[model samples]
Target: MRPLLLLPLLITTASAADAVITYDEHIKPIFREHCLKCHGEDEQKADLNLANFTAVLKGGSGDKAVVAGRASTSLLFKAITAEDDAERMPPKKAAIPAPQIELIRQWIQGGLRESSASKSLVAARDTSFKAATALNFDGPPPMPESLPAFTPPQLKRPLPVIAMAASPRAPLIAVAGHEHVRLLDATTQQEIGALPFPEGQPNVIRFSRDGRVLMVAGGKPVQSGSVVLFEVKSGKRLTSVGDETDAVISADLSPDQKLIALGGSGKIVKVYGTDDGKLRHKLTKHTDWITALAFSPDGKSLASADRAGGIHLWDGTSGGILLTLAEHKAAVRALAWRSDSHMLASGGEDGLLIWWDTTDGWPAITNTNAHPPVRPAGYYGKLPNGVLALAFGPQGELLSAGRDKQVRLWAADGRALKSFASETALPLQTSITFDGKGLFAGDAAGAVRFWTTAN
Candidate 1:
């Protein structure tokens, strides 16, 4: 009888140790004991009701309480683990026990499972984009022939252009406008058509490598966010990815068009499938808002940068970290990979432009004053020196715009070739034409301008 009782006790202990940590089984009990008084059915604080799993995920008035795959970045975890007595949860009480806090961490890191029978709500699929031998096109490049027409949205004022992209294979330019994308001809500089983005203002616009599709990514800040894709020819909405709580700040589609990687104020890089829109990978390594993202043209590497100046190169398919290229001391504003995938150029608020050799992740060329400020005659407070945008030409040339109100060109070997001054309005975005004979730029004053290459 004693032996049988001991065997049952042993089995129960083993089962408890191995069972999944879930909201219903483990988390709710803890909340009820410690959190329910101020955040439950009867009473709510900070517009937060933590009586159920949904409410917990919905978060309070601020950022989301629990980020699905990252416990370290979750607000709930921070609240419970805070060092200050006043800011910590259960306000005046001691912090949660270490073991219980660990359980919460596991619950979040395990995709916030509600029960043992439940699937992970934020599981990443194993997917990768395979690169082709070369970016070769058989016929004339894809162009919008008969796109469906749409009325452009009327704005209170012209929205400041936030993003822009030039088609790699076509004489086309996509410019972000107020709740719409304006397509323009690179040669004539005339409006071709408009695509409505009902989601919100677009913060990032990108054309696929083959120039067959365009992607627009953004949404209402602190409310919702997403990425929308469109067929360049028919203007058909291809697909949308992500359901984020804040606007997506940076995004890029892989050269093969099989994967889309995006990041936002959430500080997480999410790669999703273009066909099915399922999340493929969630990279939570950045400590600040992601400011830039780019996939190598050859489709092997994905480079992402953050507001804190961190940059990481990842395997395009597996989402594994390949290298951490750390040189910039301020926000990295733009990242552009060379066509051959051998080099990457990064511009940052530190006023430095660096070209990294992908072979060993070393800075091949570092321009300390890529866009030196030109202050006016007697105004000596400080002039803007940040590199705001970057684009690469077909022949390895580079175009960059800076907060100094100048647009400049550079040779493949880091030689300064030409410079165009914007005079008043700051140039915010830039793109080079396919033939490398023209330049397109959007400025802070809500103007999109074009220039021919100087003789």
Candidate 2:
């Protein structure tokens, strides 16, 4: 009898034992004994019903209980295996058996199957973002034809414009406002249209590679969060991705528009599928909240920076860690990739603007004190010199704003071309127009100011 028990335990831990797990055959009995009382047919907790296979797959309360192939991110698995007594399932009850937890994990990772003959429901995806060999602009760039009518919220005061983006191929700019986004004609500096952001304030605005789609990422702080997409030509709401516990501070879409990566209060950088909204990869290497994220225009690499000033460049295709850039000593505020994707730029709160050559992960140019503090005599302590935002121009020039309340333009060789000073507001965001003739900067005072190379 002792040998028989030991034999089964050994098989469970052996690498050769890759047994198929199904909900009907293996999971039903375990849930009936431990989870049915609270989450089964009789009573549903948090609106989650785990009584049947379909119900478990459907999820509840606007969240999925079982994410097909990700056991670690599945709500059902997290609940049953939670370390906290309060969050753990079967409230106040003894922990579920280790074997049972293992079974559940196998069920999810092997794909949530209904029975022995049912098909595996694992979300198999190609994570790579293949860039186009060359950008082909056949005609004029896409613009909104007819947008849905939306009543703009009457604001008592202008909300701080924290996020903004310029189209890669058009004279348009999207500026984030309070629960809304304003589209401006870069040439005229006039409002062309507006789009509603029912989700909280838009923390990050991005245009797709072709400038045909708009991606806005944000949500109510300390509450719900998600990424919203819209068709640029029609102002049609496309889809929303991610359901985070807090606001997403930074996010970007791949060059092919196949993947969306976002981060916020959580240290993890979650990449999701644009079509199915499934969690594809969780880059958990960051030690602090992710403050900046961007993918290379060539769609070969991804860069994620954190509040701790840690910057990591990853393989854009497989999400593999490529390089850990250790330079900034404070929060990273912005990340920009050149059109050719050979160079990457990062601005941080430490007042350093570094240009990195992605080929070998070396700093090609480091601008220490990129934003020199303008302090009068007797100014004490640390005068603010943090680089707030960065943008790349078409000709490989760079635009940067900083705590110095000045927006400066830099040449491809890191030479200071010109500086535009904003006397009233501190610039927080900056973007360059497609043709490299115009630039836009959003400030702390909720103003989206426009300028050109001639300035």
The lDDT leader among the candidates is 2
RMSD of each: 20.6, 21.2
Collision pairs in model 1? none
Q: Rate the local accuracy (lDDT) of all candidates.
A: 0.83, 0.84
Total clashing residue pairs per candidate? 0, 0
Native-referenced Cα lDDT, model 1? 0.83
TM-score of 1: 0.70
Q: List ranges where model 2 is wrong by over 4 Å.
A: 1-134
lDDT of 1 by residue, 1-455 (tens): 00011011011111123457899998998888889999999988887777899899899898688987556468888899877889999888878888788788778766798888888665453111222355577778877788776888776778777999999889999999888899998888888888889999899999988788999999999988999999988889989999999999999999889999999898999999998999999988899999999999878899999999899999999999999987787899999987777778999998878777786676656675778886789997966689999998887888899987878887776767777777548899999988888887799988877777755
Residues 138-159 of candidate 2 have per-residue lDDT tens digits of 6689887798887779988888
Q: Model 2, poorest ten-residue lDDT window?
A: 1-10
